[model samples]
Target: MVVLKMKTISLKVNGITKEITVEDNELLLNVLREKLGITSVKAACWRGECGLCTVLLDGIPVKSCMTLAVETDGKEVITAEGLYSDERAKKLMESFVKHGAMQCGFCTPAFVVTSHYVLTKNPEVDGEELKKELNGVICRCGTYYQIYEAVKDAEKYYKKETKS
Candidate 1:
């Protein structure tokens, strides 16, 4: 008989620390969406090509679909929902809404999380760099321009925060 080893892992999702048991070979995407009930980490292309399952692992964006649950042990993951309390993220969200960047809304969460990371890392990122940084997540509705504008609009908030 084949046996799957179950292991306990402690991971923080959306600012909440959770210690849960999972199979040794379980994927982080599954653990986050299924076990932890974090639906923002979409499951479009399970192969990680879509980047919809992206999450900030230890403050760096990574495809949860491509990561193993065991690897996330003792790691901190931040999703779009986790950034809700941040002033910059709030501005970003507002900008997205104002610019109508969330058509269809399927990829919004991932884009938000990545965009938040980019703004946090480099609030002064230019258009080309922002485009490159956001290339990982695809918006099927072709709302790229709006998304770009939204991110740019929110840049000032991050810059202000940085100066403070």
Candidate 2:
């Protein structure tokens, strides 16, 4: 009989460097929530379709559940927590609040992360494009309308800031 052992890898998560031993098949989401205590990245569909596990890999959104821990070595992973401190994030949070975009909160973190990507990538996105981008994320709480409005509002807020 042969036995295979997991390998330890070092990764920079939310600007902090960490070295963790994980199974070869371990997903980044598990390692993040279980090992690193980054619970903001939800563990929902695990299949990558839900986008509930979205996290920023060097500033691009990637489904953490579908990403291998080993593959994240030497890469920077930013979760919803990282965005909480950002100025744009503050505006987004305010919009979500004003629009009542958050219901159960299970999907709020993912929504926020995805919206952050949308706003950062194209701050000029219209309401239609905002809906398209948000379509990638699923909110079982049925807060779609509010979510869309929040993203659109955040886009306007961010654009105004950049132009000022």
Candidate 3:
């Protein structure tokens, strides 16, 4: 008889503390979407080439599919759902919609997450610098210009929001 070993991981997901038991080999993407029902973290391009599984791990953008579930133990994670609660993120979403940055909607969440990370880290980044910063996220719909514009506008709005 073979006994499978399981690890219990407790991590904060979208401002909520969640404890889940997972196999040693299980990926964070699976646990998030399957166990916790956080579908915003997509498993597209399991090899991490697509950047569709991007999420904020300890306030830093990371690919969920490539991270092991056990590695997230006692860590902080924020998905698109969590971002929605932030004022700056809401403004960013509005900017994306206004600029038509999303088409198929499959990659919007990842882009939004990345944009929030970039803008929060460097509020003044613009032009080619902004593009290079967000190069990790890939939108198959060819909405780069729209995404850039939205991010640019969002940076301004976010700055304004923080001022008040």
Model 2 TM-score (2 dp): 0.91
Best by lDDT: 1
Q: Candidate 1, residues 1-164: lDDT per residue as tens digits?
A: 77878899998888888998999889999988888888988999888788999999999999999999999999999998899988889889999999999768999999999999999999999899999999999899999999999999999999999999
Models 1 onward score TM values of 0.96, 0.91, 0.94
Cα lDDT of model 3 by residue, 14-35, tens digit: 9999888999889999988999
Clashing pairs in 2: none
Which one is best on TM-score? 1
The worst-scoring run of ten residues by lDDT in candidate 1 lies at: 1-10
Question: Is candidate 1 or 3 superior in TM-score?
Answer: 1
Candidate 3 regions exceeding 4 Å error are: 1-3, 161-164
Better of 1 and 3 by lDDT: 1
Whole-model Cα lDDT of every candidate shown, in order: 0.92, 0.86, 0.90
